[model samples]
Target: MHDSQVFFELLSENTSKEVWADSAYRSEENEWMLKAGGYRNRPLNKRAQQSNRRKSRIRARVEPVFGSMENEMGGLFIRMIGRARAKTKIGLMNLVYHLKRCASLWKSRQ
Candidate 1:
C-alpha cells in the first residue's frame, strides 16, 4: 500500500496539531481526514512558484537535520524490537545530534 494510505494511522500518535508533508500526500481523502481530525495541514504546493518558494524556505531549515541523521548518524531506520527500546534509542540519538550540533557551533565560534 502507498505510505499515504497508512500515514493517517499514526496521526493520533503525534503530540503536535500540525501536519506537514509534500505533494505526494495531497489528496481529497487526506484533506478530509486532516480537517476532521482538526490538524493544521501544511501541504507543499506543487504549483505557484512564489508560494512554493516561501514554503521551501521553511523546509530548508528542516531538511538538513533529517539528512544529517540519515547520512551521518546512520539513518532513521531503527532496528530495535520494541517501542520502549526504540524510543530510548531515538531519544539518545536525538540527544547526540544536539550535542554534536553544539560542538560544531562551539568550534565555529572559537
Candidate 2:
C-alpha cells in the first residue's frame, strides 16, 4: 500500500489527499502520516469494522466488476515476460471488456 501511494504520486504529479483500503492496510504509522499530510484515510478499522456503510456498498458493486474481468475477460494472468508486454496484454484485455460491455448495452437497448 505504501509503495503504491508513492508510485501513484509520482505518476499523477500530485499528492493524494484520500485513500481507501482494506483492514490489512491499518497501521498507526500510516494513519499518522496520512493525518499529517491532511489525507482522508479510509482504511477499515483494526477490528475490521467499516466506518461507513455506503463505502461498503460501493465496494460490493466494484468487486463484481473485477471478478468479471478475471473470470470472463481473461485478465487474471499475463503469460508475457516483460513489463511492456504485460501492459499491452492488460490493455488489450481492457479494450475487449469495454467493447463487450458496449455491445451488451446496445443489445439491451435493441
Candidate 3:
C-alpha cells in the first residue's frame, strides 16, 4: 500500500479507468486511493463471493500469457544487475511476446 501512489503514477495518460488486480491489492484504504485517482478498482476479494468468481474469470484470461512468457519465452530470469537493465530486459521480453503473438495470428489466418 505504501508504494500504491508510485505504481498508480506509472500508468500512462491513455490508461483505462479500470484497474484489474489481485487480492493482495484489496483494502479500504486502497479502494479510497483508487477512487480518488479516478480509477475503478477491480481487485479480487479474499472471501468466497460472486465478485471473487468474476475476478478469477477475468484473471484467467491473462494467466496463459504470463505463463507462456515465463516458460516458453525465457522471461523468468533477469540476467541484468541494475534496475535500468532489468527494465530494459523486461521491455525486450514484451516486444518479443508481441512479435510472437503477431506471428501466431498471421499463421492462423492462412
Candidate 4:
C-alpha cells in the first residue's frame, strides 16, 4: 500500500477504460470496482484470467521502485542536522530519484 495515491494516479493517467486492474483497487467506498459493467468484468475464459494475473503483476513492479528509492538512492530514514533542511533535502532527493527512474525507463525503451 506504499504510494497508493501515486499508483492510482499512474493507473488513471496511463490506462483506458478497456483495461482491468484485477483485485488491487478495492475500497470500502467502492466494493465492486473490477466487477462492474465495463472492461473490468470477467471474460469467462482462460485468456482473461491470464490478463487479470498480468494486471496483478503490475503491483509488483512498484517494489523495485521502492527498493531503488531506499537502497540505490540512500535509505529512507534521513539524519540531518535540522528538521526544515532535512525535509527539503529529502524532497529534493526523492524528486531526483524519480527523475532518474523515468530517464532510465525512457532510455531502455529507446
Candidate 5:
C-alpha cells in the first residue's frame, strides 16, 4: 500500500479512541474514517486550535530530543532493509542516547 493508505491502516489499528494528529491529516475521508473507527478527532485545525496549545506545551518537551538526535546523533536515519533491522537500529540508537545522557548527568554531578 501507499504511504497515505498506511496512515489509515495505522489509524484503524490504534487502540486509543482519541486521535491527536497534525492538520495535514485533516480531510473529509480521514474524518469519516476516524468517526467510523470511533475516534475523537483532534487535528490541529482552527476550530481545534485552542486545545492544541496545551498539547503543544507537552509536545515541546519531547521535541528537543528529536533535535538532539538530528544534530548530535547525525539524524535518526536507519538505513536497514527491513522493519526488524530498523527496529534494532533504533533500539541501539536509544541505548546510545541513554548512555550519553547518563554520562552527562554524572559529569554534571561531579
Candidate 6:
C-alpha cells in the first residue's frame, strides 16, 4: 500500500474523490470515496465497466497520434538536449502537427 501524501500532493486541489489505482490505496476509510479502475479483487460496478471501455477507446486514438509524431514529425528520440528544452520543443511540434492535420482535413472537403 502506498502513502497518500505523495499522490495527494501531486493531484490538483480540485480533485476530491481519489481514483483508486490498485490495492495500494485500499483502506476502510477510502472505500466509499475511491473508485477502482482496474480488474482486481475489488468488486465491479457499471461505472468501472464503462470507465475501462472508455480507456480502451482512448488508447486507440493514441496510436495514430504517436504514429504521426514518428512518421511525420520524427520520433520523440530526435537529438534533443535536456529535459526542459526537449519538452518545450516536443510541445511546439505537436501543436504544429495538430494545426496541419486540421488544415488538411478542411482542404480535403473543398
Winner by lDDT = 1
Q: After superposition, how far is residue 51 of candidate 5 from its true place, in Å?
A: 3.0
Q: List the residue pairs that clash in candidate 5.
A: none
TM-score of each predicted structure versus truth:
0.52, 0.46, 0.49, 0.39, 0.48, 0.46
TM-score of 5: 0.48
- TM-score winner among the candidates? 1
Model 2 clash pairs are none
Q: What does candidate 5's lDDT look like per residue over 19-81, in tens digits?
A: 676667777888888788777654457756877787889889888777778888889877889
Q: 1-110, model 1: which lDDT tens digit per residue?
A: 87777888777688988787777898899889888989875544567567879878988988878888899889999998999999998898788888999999999999
lDDT of 2: 0.70
Rank by lDDT, highest first. 1, 5, 3, 2, 6, 4
Can you list the residue pairs that collide in candidate 1?
Answer: none
Candidate 3 residue lDDT tens string, 1-110: 55544555554443678676655667887778778988864544566468678887988987877887888887677877899998987888788888998999999999
lDDT of 6: 0.68
lDDT per residue for candidate 2 within 1-110, as digits (tens), equals 56545643543455456566555555786677667767775646655565467578998977876787898876677788899998987788778877888998999999
Candidate 1 residue spans exceeding 4 A from truth:
1-47
Worst 10 residues of 6 by lDDT: 32-41
Clashes of 2: 0
lDDT by residue (1-110, candidate 6, tens digit) is: 44564544444453444354555665664454333422224455999889988997997888777888888886878576788888898888889889988999999999
Q: Tell me, what's the RMSD of every candidate? A: 10.9, 11.4, 12.8, 12.2, 10.0, 11.2
The alpha-carbon lDDT assigned to residue 101 of candidate 1 equals 92
Determine which window of 10 residues in candidate 1 has minimal summed lDDT. Answer: 40-49
Instruction: Put down candidate 4 lDDT per residue, 2-78, tens digits, no spaces.
Output: 54445445655655665444345556533354345244544547886787689769868767766777888777777
After superposition, the stretches of candidate 2 with alpha carbons farther than 4 Å from their true spots are 1-52, 57-61
Runs of candidate 4 exceeding 4 Å displacement: 1-62
**How many clashing pairs in candidate 6?**
0
List candidate 3 segments past 4 Å from native. 1-49
Model 6 off-target regions past 4 Å?
1-52
Please give the lDDT score for candidate 5. 0.77
* Candidate 1 structure lDDT: 0.84
